[model samples]
Target: MSSTTTEVLQRKPRNVAVNTNPEHGLHLVESDVPEPGPKDCLVHVRATGICGSDVHFWKHGKIGDMIVVGENGLGHESAGIVIKTGSEVTRFKPDVVFFSTPPYDGTLRRYHVHPEAWLHALPDRLSYEEGSLLEPLSVALAGIDRSNLRLGSALVICGAGPIGLVTLLAAHAAGAAPIVITDMDENRLQVAKKLLPRVRTVKVAREDAAKDLGTRIIETLGTEAELVLECTGVESSIQAGIYATRFGGSVFVIGVGKDFQNIPFMHLSSKEIDLRFQYRYHDTYPKAINLVNEGLIDLKPLVTHRYKLDDGVDAFATASTPGARAIKVQILDD
Candidate 1:
């Protein structure tokens, strides 16, 4: 818990995001903590979660147009206590937790400043680890919202990562029936089955997932899918979701894919299915907090490992490697 400054500029070095190159991984260097301007709150980060998107940036040095940003502060999913509140700040106390920030200097630090709009007060039942996951959770919930999940509806979600699992959790809470989840990773599928019992877990590769899931549901239930939530962003999986969906069904694209994949839209066009793209969340934090408060989504078991700020580089490495047996990797500063 020692903090000093490097004087990269004239200001404090503890707050500088020095990763300008996307190809290189992050390093824990010193930079200045800028003073909060009006309408901003200074957050003393306690925990920051390394996301898969961060891993892609670390390995490739770019995500679409948004690069890691030199010395790239590598974080976005985070939670922390309020240290300094700007003149216009409201809606949170000093000890509250919040999340879903895009890592400009990331939450892996002693102090950082952000707008009050993104901060959501953590309920007593939710931990900082859970709070830090609001971003991905929003991606899940947004899929549910856009797909119009309702009682007795059927949903097939591809890629049993955090977003897929959370989408399964939300679908169950929304009273969707026969929720189906698919992943090639047996371990991931097992974890999802144990953590979330509502979703029927299936092991299907991108090549066979569509016909596999579609055939099973089509034969057993005698009905096509009402909605498809594609959480993998893999090309074949995207086509799988599109093909498996019932006529006039909706597909919500929630994963962060930096590449383009060939999606055979013949089924979509012939079936007249609706395909919607869901990007980074907007106006979903409060509902996310409420969802956690109302017991709609349980995020406790989602976090598989924890590391410290100094080990952030390894955290990204861990997040980048799927075989590391990590679900949601978190970084703790307190």
Candidate 2:
């Protein structure tokens, strides 16, 4: 079950937030701090990470058909502190608050009221910023878990964005060897290489990705990958993933793409490739939090930009700018 606090806001302290409209880019808005109902808790948002989907909404006001009809906030990757809880709530108390998935008003605001079932305690080992990263980390872990990667399995990640980088680290932890990553952006490729020096990195050319990626992968890594994780929604990158996977191997599509995409189905069938896909996540929060606490996956390096809740405009502007070299932009509540 899910619900947004936007509807039941109280007319007292003005809660500042950033909203995205189709015509008006991203602008600040004020709303009343919401009060929790039975089984719900009021959260004082501390840190919110800007996601690619958030940037997509800020720039185009929609991701595919999920457009901003009137006024909408833009943030889901978040962590905060629970200020109060309803009489019926049992699981959560006054402490650090966990985050939830989409279809809600988002966590860009200073305050939020959400159900206790959707909340998880922020571990003492992780800061609010690190806690916010659990969302994307969960996405990467879900995709990797579905790929069924085994020890010493050759892995190739298409697209070196936040998801791809996380997959690289997770694959290493899962015992995948000689990993190779591909991306068109030189900066992102450099960041990935810096993070994992042993893994091979490839910069995809401007031409057809599928036609050229296979040759490059074979040349650099000595063979087709046993598992190819596609983290970019770009059509060419998805095509490259199919071409880079070995026969009988799997190609896990983790990126959210357009409603329709044309792919080479014949090639996939002839190669006996297992084409898989990933949704947001499921049953991954505890595992992710534990992994980070154990230093198994490092997410702090991914946060390349920071902003205050008051600098909503500049923050969204930096996040929406193309090739900004910003892997993750975080907003700290004032």
Score each candidate by Cα lDDT.
0.72, 0.81
**How much is 221 displaced in model 1, in angstroms?**
6.7
Q: How does residue 181 of candidate 2 score in lDDT? A: 93
Q: What TM-score quantifies how close candidate 2 is to the native fold?
A: 0.92
* lDDT tens readout by residue for model 2, 1-334: 1133333343355688877775756788898777789988888788888888887776666666677676777788888877667999877643344442234477888888878888888777788888888888888889878789889998888889888898888888898987999888889999998888888988888785575777688677778889988998878888888888788989889987887998889999999999888866788888988899899988899999999998978987887776678888899984
For each candidate, give its TM-score against the true structure.
0.87, 0.92
Give each prediction's root-mean-square deviation over alpha carbons.
Answer: 4.3, 4.3
Off by over 4 Å in 1: 1-20, 94-103, 206-222
Candidate 2 ranges beyond 4 A from true positions: 1-13, 93-103
